[model samples]
Target chain A: MEESNWEPKVIGFLCHWCSYAGADLSGSARLEYPHNIRIIRIPCSGRVDPMFILRALQNGVDGVLVSGCHPGDCHYQSGNFHARRKFAVINRLLKYVGIEPERVQFSWVAASEGPKMAQVIGEFVEGVRKVGPNRLFKDEKKDGE
Target chain B: MENRLKEEAGKLLKEGKVDYIVGYGKGTVNLRTSPLITNKEEDLEGLVINPFIANNLSRYPVELKGRVGIVVKGCDSRSLTSLMQDKKVKREDLIIFGVPCEGVVDLKKLAGQIGAEIDRVTDAEKEGENLTLQVDGSKKTIPFRDVIFDKCYGCEHPTPLEYDMLLGSEVAPNLDIEKSLERIKELEGMDAQERWNYWKEQFSKCIRCYGCRNVCPACFCERCFVDVNMPQWVATYATWQDNLTFQLIRTLHVAGRCSDCGECERACPVGIPLRSLQRKMVEEVKDLFGHEVGIDKDAPPVFSHYEATDPDEFMK
Candidate 1:
């Protein structure tokens, strides 16, 4: 890369029951991971509407990561499963319309899997860095760049 | 078939069986039809089922409060079935008149082929498989397949699957889905940037008219997300970015529910290829869930119910 220090700004939506707690556990353990991600705690990944991801992209976030309980381990019986259906459709659709697939990622991170969460973030940020900035909705008129 | 439909509609109104008869009548313009909604017995004579009846009447029954007798072609019936599946319309509350359709003519193709405006054509008569057009004292003939709507190419249901009375004999589907989806495959063949730019250019022409939303039978939201300004989901302005946002959100919103009716594309005034996005989603939903929309009236909506073994390769 030109600058060699340009880190990607990624937004992580973590479910309160699993992925959020996993982030907490990673912090407690003093894990070594990239600080490029800003986490938003949600009740469940099922609550992450497809609009939220699109808004993040439109708002110019470099990447978006949605993490929740593993299938069948949802806090609300079938929340993750429902979320999976939406994710499947949205991911395919977003990429079909030419958004970089690496810009959005979905993962499962249980409370006990703190190391995995750190590693997931590390890998996701690296992938985002490869894809470069989010220019999908760049408003040249407003930005005046 | 037209006589039988008129007689049955007359009987329905005369016997107070339905509160309204939703069908099509000859529009003032040549080679066009407007939705004909009426409760009077005299209007039955105005009902004309022809090759030019293109508008899907399924969206009407959802709003009409009382008992309704609506006419349906293949795609319109599927849309009705989808609305019924969602409990938006009750079966007992309405009577359905099924018209066995070969395929409706596409006016845009006709205009382009004849190198003239659709309104200029004085008369269009269907003779078996060819259309004889009388344009300014000149008679020109064209095959029916060359001018039919793209959705009609692969229509799976040429007759209503669940109708009280059959207007005519059931016809076979042409099964030329590839012919309709040619544009979609072209888009997919492009690289990410090219595809994005293609849609950007298409959406830039959008004037923010909600014609696509209004005509879509699946877009039956009472309070659409776009109308709500509390959170200000999408900006009201007609900026190209917001237009893209509006269509992207709309396409996602009607993912499984969309029957690929092509009404949204047909309704676009600026000639955006909206059917490509919708038809692509149809392909994805079909591949992802093996679920064809509006096929069965009893099953739960595609997203409401999920299989335990659903594809999870995309997720971590």
Candidate 2:
């Protein structure tokens, strides 16, 4: 299919204390992962409001991944815990609207797991590729030409 | 419905008790009764009370301070109760001429049935079992059972729950609350993912007009969390995420206190079923704490007061 031939545009939000550092380590280790993932570092996972994810999708991004500190390991202690409950709500909302749930991913990535980060991104990119582009929002516009 | 309501308004103006009398008048448009605050007695001629008055005129008591008189129906009186709970208005500062509501006509539904825009429907009469609308161009007869608001269906509480000067016969509260109960029960059966998807579709269409918050009589917060920018809780942008955050926060904030007046649903331009969320939250509050809003002023919020016997399963 023509969709598999094109590289997916994936946006990732990484917590500064853990997930962001993990990405940096992955780069230092010369690990190979899909370059489609564009990482944005935030102070904590709690700072990533549901608005960011919706804005990204509305702007034509194919997928979103929010990675934070492992459970109970947040730099602010309960930041990731709050984030977990919030994302659960957002995930439910997105799926209900007929958008494929595979397009949005949420997982924990500790700072030390550089190889694991690379593997996770690779799997996410593959999953997003299989889902193809989001047609729900795109169809809202007219003018086929 | 009473000569005293108009007489008192004239007396209040002549006695200089108030600056204005906020009441209902014949709508300049078709079929609707619009709210009017008149300082003159001649303007009071348009004032008439019947099943057609649907607005919660008690809301103006807070904003139109310094002594005012408002026409109250049963649901409108709840706004008055909520306003007093928040201390937005003082009881002694105003006069309430409460009317016993048999039921208010749902003008939107009535318009659809009659196939004509209701332009100043005056002289509505209950003839046997049907309501006859006296419109400008034509007289349309609609069944009394049809065109009444769903909230008023089998509603025995047609009289104002509370009033200073009663104007009509007292009405009783209809005991049928099964319809609202059934809707919540149906939603509870959906899986988590299915529920999430359902709400996402509903909330994604939000235009973020903030009409729901503005129209809510209980939502009298000086600085709504959505409007605050110091911490920047929810984004100001009109994205689905921001919209969801705004709705969830508003729903949770009014969980135990929402009166389910259906004002938010009526005010929405997009026709979003806001009552679903508000009613859902109210049902949850009732099931969890056995609390119903607008019942007593002294009772604390459901979340604020927790018993030792409370279930701790949701708590990690």
Candidate 3:
């Protein structure tokens, strides 16, 4: 638990049509990105409920990233568009409740954007690292044990 | 006003226009009222309209099965409008008896000022800007402004905005949206850590009573996420994290649908300042989506519809 060795635990929810493919492309291209993220493949960004992000944070993830297809490029036509609206409300709500806005990030990564996907992940990990661990939702009793 | 309310209820009952009228009856304790649903003309005598009538009758209509008549204040009417907009209640099934409100008093504040536990409030009367309360055979005069709930101070609708029949003369709304905005701005000025600590301390006091959610008119879901066990969305425990998660989820769920009736805050046993959380979303829905809930029946909810030009400054 030394400060210099500390690495944030991040959860990345990648939509199947675009962000998932972009992540796959990153792996195939062997691009270097932060190893902290644990990816959860979802059908589409619209399927990612705000509860999922909250649950992840409550269970002690340091950060969460929801990556979807570009708004117009959604595989389900307007799924990403709907998700964009939902995420906007959710983001503002989290910030209003005093949670760090940087901890929960949203992005649009196309199926062809391998380098961009890697860069987004790298940047998010670094941002979360600077904020240190998410102590807001951590259970102190469990931590002590 | 009480006689007029009883007369209306009697007429509606005798005419067979409504299955039952939802109104307020004297609570077992003084200075309190309870929801009373009655179909009999004789029961109409129990229907009362006083400054102590704090229960929102709008919540009863949704669970009712036939044509129903209900008495509503300005805030209750807004909640009814939201229910209609959400398709939870049908206008054709409702016969609204609107009452102009001069704001309701917070009994706690009144009791605190008196410096004694009130065994019984024998009589209560409001004249002009003062309320004379006969508590335990002793009369005490308190300014109406001093005893009124905080929600009523800047009440934007003293008269029902939408009603089938008006029971009294309309009163002008005391606009308080600016005051709400100022408080939000003050909170925004605090650093993230300070804000987080503030909420953490506030949420830690929650007892998991769920009174806030139960009393809210907007929380009409058949299966609330917290009750869903197949994939449990939130812990049922009263830990700060669980309480915070439950509150955040509930607030987001009611973002565009909340009428700011202050029922949740009023019902909260812990006095968690629930309205602050709700008003934040209310303010944001207005600023970011250009939408206000329960104002127009035709308009879709703020989140249900979005313009392509909606702000996306946070997205990468």
Best by TM-score: 1
lDDT of each: 0.91, 0.72, 0.86
lDDT of 2 by residue, A3-119 (tens): 446788899999999989999899999999999999999999889877677657756789998889877788987787766655654554454334577788887888998998898
* Candidate 1 regions with alpha-carbon error over 4 angstroms: A1-5, A141-145
Chain B structural similarity as TM-score, candidate 1 = 0.98
Candidate 2 on B1-316: residue-level lDDT in tens? 5576777778878888877788887676655678888878788777867666766777777777578877888777766765666667777787778888777788787878877666656557777569987776468788976777666753435677767778867866654566535555566677644665666677778888999888877677879988888867777877665676577667666665676777787778877677767776655566555776655545554544544343323221
The DockQ values of the predictions, listed in order, are 0.83, 0.07, 0.72
Docking class of 1: high
Residue range B11-30, candidate 1, lDDT tens digits: 99999999999999989898
Docking class of 2: incorrect
Cα misplacement distance, residue A40 of candidate 3 (Å): 1.0
Model 3 lDDT, residue B256, Cα: 79
Worst 10 residues of 2 chain A by lDDT: A136-145
DockQ of candidate 2 (2 decimals): 0.07
